[model samples]
Target: MGISKISEFDCIIFCVYAVEYRTVSGVAGPLVILEKVKGPKYQEIVNIRLGDGSTRRGQVLEVDGEKAVVQVFEGTSGIDNKYTTVQFTGEVLKTPVSIDMLGRIFNGSGKPIDNGPPILPEAYLDISGSSINPSERTYPEEMIQTGISTIDVMNSIARGQKIPLFSAAGLPHNEIAAQICRQAGLVKRLEKTTNLLEGGEEDNFAIVFAAMGVNMETAQFFKRDFEENGSMERVTLFLNLANDPTIERIITPRIALTTAEYLAYECGKHVLVILTDMSSYADALREVSAAREEVPGRRGYPGYMYTDLATIYERAGRIEGRKGSITQIPILTMPNDDITHPTPDLTGYITEGQIYIDRQLQNRQIYPPINVLPSLSRLMKSAIGEGMTRRDHADVSNQLYANYAIGKDVQAMKAVVGEEALSSEDLLYLEFLDKFERKFVAQGAYDTRNIFQSLDLAWTLLRIFPRELLHRIPAKTLDQFYSREAASH
Candidate 1:
């Protein structure tokens, strides 16, 4: 029998072989326990019928002989042990996916909430996807331009890489995530040069966005932004509102990634999956663990948090012979801005690298507010260079970083002593610092820059320092791009 028919609990039997247990021994939060159950498989789907005939769906979290614990997706607030009936469907939870899922919005439980027609399933995929074989996986090399200078020029994100945004509360991580979704696309390389504007086409790209435990305002903001920017046509959104059941948050990302995998591998489209506020997801895991009475680890979080996160992150990549690829950009808000928090700490170990959003930069009115010092993309080197971006891309990036580091140091020194006490070279470094933050790092929310535009702006800031002081840049590259007259006094 189908899930649609099973939802109507009036039927005595969901399936011919399905067993019904009227003995619900316990109901704690979203979990319900069934005692004296037999032959129930792990992860099996269950339907609970209340006294009023209302039905809720659940999955077996653990099964031991004739006892099973099921996690109810809709929560068990009013469920009574005496009146509740648990029906085992003998099937696992599966999400229906189709190419038409683009432009559609789904709730945390994978149900359509967009007021659109129900999804005509191309196939029902298990949310727990199979891990890709290591031998069959291909290395990521092609760069995906986010149109944000801080990301594209400095820490480049390659296709099929799993990179995350590290932010804290009160930051504009949501805005940044939305901007990237609207502007991200493949940067077609033109003839061994790093100039991205001359001849490049945005590839056929798709986005699967999942928002966990976000408020109504945030949800509407994303929906409106996607629609306004015309990106909704190529995007699929999964929203788990703040009032949604905590258990549903745990299933949201899996459904999103499963849809992404289908779109990437089956439809031959480059899919970008953006999961925001993973902190809420982790909280939900902790809540479930607490309900299950499992032993708590760091900060009352489950000890298996690292392995659990990996199951989601490792799903993003390219198979050797597949025509499409899946890339992930997960955003997590660090509690109290602690980088060492178990959430981001464990994430750092599993993912490629992280992009840290600084609160100070945000307070300074910087658009992206990304702190370049602590942020890095481990896969950047493989995706940029001669014939990819430009031959001088690497050297220019290094020089920019080196000069910025010195500029910061000089700023500290200037604060210690008056500006007049500093030398001319130190004064020039300070000027470079201002231009870097204003012209290079800071851009309008909607302003999208090509790789060439970003590099040109970098050169403009670099020219503030005398060529003699540019120790990080090679002499050959200096001759090609540096003009003697452009150097400041």
Candidate 2:
């Protein structure tokens, strides 16, 4: 009989013939230490069988000659070191991939928890996918409209760019993320009107959303939001609840990225991977490091936290000869609103740019309170202007930044000298600051705007200043878009 058709007895005999080590030396929280292990590879999957004939899954975190440290995914609370057996699977952890993954809800370990049918594997891909060669990388230039004025106008997201939303606790970052997932796409009107510029094809667009260590309420909110907006069809969601095993948090993003890679590279889809509350993921890493008795770096995180984060962030990009691309918008809440905290600090160095959400704005009742000045998209310049968004996009953006800077300076002066002491020009700038925050940066949570509408609104605001003060915009652009009647204000 073929090996595949072997009886249960034969299978047991084959398992008995395979190498098994009963050398579990110690259990530390979620980790298991194995001594006298021979040639155990790092990241190798291990099966731990207990005395009750139940098996748990684990991964080899470290292998030093004959000693190996394994992190159990299901925790090690009930395992007895004397009777447990560890068997190395001779393979790294992998996730099954298929096009049907869209609209499916998965747990942290990539297992479907929605009571849906099992995933029919088209292929199995290593969760730790190989990095794209730098030589094979294509520069990201296409603009992705999130329909939020602050993001669309100022910190524009681009295809294949790793842009993170740096937020703090109690901010509306979740609402903003949900809005983007609902409204993000290439503007079809722009494509139809300006055929010369590159635009995202609707059919090729997809989203992979991974929420790590969120509470049950937060998870349900995201699901309801997606389902209500009818965006679940294009989204592959991975929810790692706060109550789930902390060890599983480390694997959540990898699973999400693996599915994104399958969709983008193999299935030729433009995928946006949204990872939220990365602080929780980082905390999980710190916990695992502590469990392993490893020395901690800044803020008790692992010494290799930066390198480990790079493994996840660097997965987003465009490869040469591939029609699809992966763009990442990772969201992490700054601890105590401290951006200098290790989590946000390390992420800032790895990502292309960041979108900062302000607490002050949220407190002011602004729905999507994106703080414009501190936020930026480094790839925005190449992705906007001429045929891409609009001919006046770059000029308008620059003028808005310049005017907003001046307005902020004037506001500071007003606060120091009192508003009564301010000149008419300073007062005008003060008004501009207020209007900019209220009208430009803030919008209703569900309201969506295209590039044209956002730019038009920008022009309307800029016209509040005298035409002579608008030096950033070219004369021709002024003639084309400027409204002289509104400039009288």
Listed per candidate, the RMSD to the true structure in angstroms reads 6.2, 5.1
Judged by whole-model lDDT over C-alpha atoms, candidate 2 comes out at 0.89
Q: Identify the candidate with maximal lDDT.
A: 1
Model 2, which residues run further than 4 Å from truth?
A: 1-16, 188-201, 484-489
- Give me the runs in candidate 1 sitting further than 4 Å from their true place: 1-16, 192-200, 484-489
Error of 2 at 470 (Å): 0.9
Task: For model 1, state the Cα shift of residue 34 in Å.
Answer: 0.9
| TM per candidate | 0.94, 0.93
Model 1, residue 68: distance off in Å is 0.7
Please provide, for model 1 over 1-489, each residue's C-alpha lDDT reduced to its tens digit, 9 standing for 90 to 100: 666554665657445666679878987778998899988889999999898989999999998899999999988888998888899998888999999999999999889999999999999999998789899999988888888999988999988999999999999999999999888888776684433464224567899999999999999999999999998999999999999999999999999999999999999998999998899999999999999999999999999999999999999899987888899999999999999999999999999999989999999998899988889999999888776676667888888888888899999998989798999999888898888998899998899987777877788888888889989888988887787453331
